[model samples]
Target: MAASPDTLARVEELTARRLNRTLLARQHLLARSTQTAHDLIHHLVAVQAQESNAPYISLWTRLEAFEKDDLTALLADRRAVRSSILRGTQHIATDDDYPWLRPTVQPVLDRGRQGAFGRVTAGVDPVELAALARKHLTGQTLTRPALARLLAERWPDVEPLALGWSAQCLLPVVHPPPSGTWGRFGATPFVLAEEWLGRPMAAPDAERLVVRYLAAFGPGSARDVQAWSGLTRLREVLERLPLRRYRTPAGVVLYDLPDAPLADEDAPAPVRLVPEFDNLLLAHADRTRVIADAHRRVVITGAVVRPTFLVDGFVRGMWSMTGAGIVLAPFEAITEAARDALTREAAELLRFAGTEGSVSFTAPGH
Candidate 1:
């Protein structure tokens, strides 16, 4: 029998909701979904800019019993090194993984160079500059200015800050220890990625890389993958693969592995505190799958997105705990039950932040 238009619309809504929950469940299992936490950690670290500890929480949620020292050990052993990869932001990637992954995201750095630092270092040669960096950083560590001074003998006019960013971003470089240590201090110093990791980075292989991303943050659209990887060429690559497709209410077409699970939109999502630049929030170009459209501004203002509080799979509000306790300010009015759940979540966040009772919210616009 032919279905009515209203029934068809309802069916589509039901499909999308079911798919959403399935997706979440799959990710929840991705850790155990694979072998050990070590295997997952080899690929699970997300990218962040200045915060060294951000990746810790990202893994903590995904894997059971993940300790800070586990990641620190990867760094010390050269199994992973901190550098710019996905989205052209700092990430901790396996040494073996960086070669291809770094080059895959190189275009982002190249584009930035063309935009800002390209003209500044116009006359200078890339090969020559890379050599200079490799030499100075080979046997020792140096801050940006110190390294820039070493280059100044050749390129006298280049800005040290811009030059340093170019070297760190464009090249395989790691900001070595003490920089990432919990209580350590001082300006961060860098080491070459190959030197620290004990091998040269690999060439780009799009198909393999795309498959890995699917495993990590899959069941997404082409744009979502592009946003996560900072590689815009993914549309052509993903289309070539045999992926299942679905239409979202917003008219965007979503793609995913054929066998991946989907979560129910109506599923009860616990109150969870996600860190700044978490893959959950930043991995998608269109975030309606996790965050609602209207409350977007409350989560992200300019370049900074507050680490948010989630209740029932939607962002109900923003949260922070002063010396008093955790405080939550909703973007719009929520139910009494949701408020209680958010308060309980706030307490958990306070516990994570090593604090006591959750604080009360200030009056709006205070």
Candidate 2:
């Protein structure tokens, strides 16, 4: 029998460059893999999906045979869903996974909701609110405002908007198909996840989840996992895992599954255009692994996650779908040949978005 990955290799030192390549490879960013959208969602745990079409664009950059409908079909087939998961935001999770992952992240969601809308919902019984939300939303899809109005009748004392936002935060609800479908903005209608899927949400399991995160995003510290997941005290979980461990060039300790592969430090990574809120950028607390300090704030300014692209496994520029055309604003200059390659990739990205767009650029230095 093969030795366990934990036992086979002693932990090795990793440089930032080596860490970046390993991250890209595990994330399927080093090369486009041929996995279907459904399989990819499960493997990655969740893909950041705040925008209506961002998940589709993300899959396009990571999968070879990915089609817009491949993800659409997963949603239609109830094989996948978009709901609040990690860090209290929308993510695409498989049908079998969301139930447990949802409950696991509830505290994070609760913390965010309480901070955002809790003052208005003060003294409200969350249990009662969640039950009423389930009752009102079961077997029906309703927008936030409309559902707020319905819920307000029950708690007329509470502000309807607060109630609506609270229901969203507290319940395991999903925005229905047309809402997250590519190139569409159907009313942000929501329904109970349990009712829609004909299955109950499984209980949260932090140990298993931590292990999975290590499998995908690891050789990472507990802080990194918490950054990706928004839960805390994960160092306690990492302490118990039977995995190899390493320290980065910065001397930060990281842990990983015993058998996980570490590519050579100088591994090649192609340029990849990612949509707003891409998990690669959002998942790690120490984002220097993929994004430099100078550009991090601009990439994720308050409530504005500008689109970004990865060149050689690290973020190099911002992009947009402006009316004039597809635009790239690089923070630094690149070779003319590199510019040519970026242009071709941007053109393909435009086509994937179902728009005919000319690629444009904002040269370095204004």
Query: Which tens-of-lDDT digit does each residue in 7-71 have in candidate 2?
Result: 42454668888889888988888989898888888889998888888999888998997879889
Per-candidate TM-score against the hidden true structure: 0.84, 0.94
Candidate 1 accuracy as lDDT: 0.67
For residue 106, model 2's alpha carbon misses the true position, in angstroms, by 0.9
Candidate 2 residues lying further than 4 Å off, grouped into runs, are 1-11
> Residues 151-216, candidate 1, lDDT per residue (tens digit)?
787777877776776677667777877576443556768877777776787887777767777766
Which residues of candidate 1, in runs, are more than 4 Å off?
1-16, 29-37, 43-49, 183-186, 321-325, 353-366
**Pairs of residues clashing in candidate 2:** 5-258, 6-258
Worst 10 residues of 2 by lDDT: 1-10
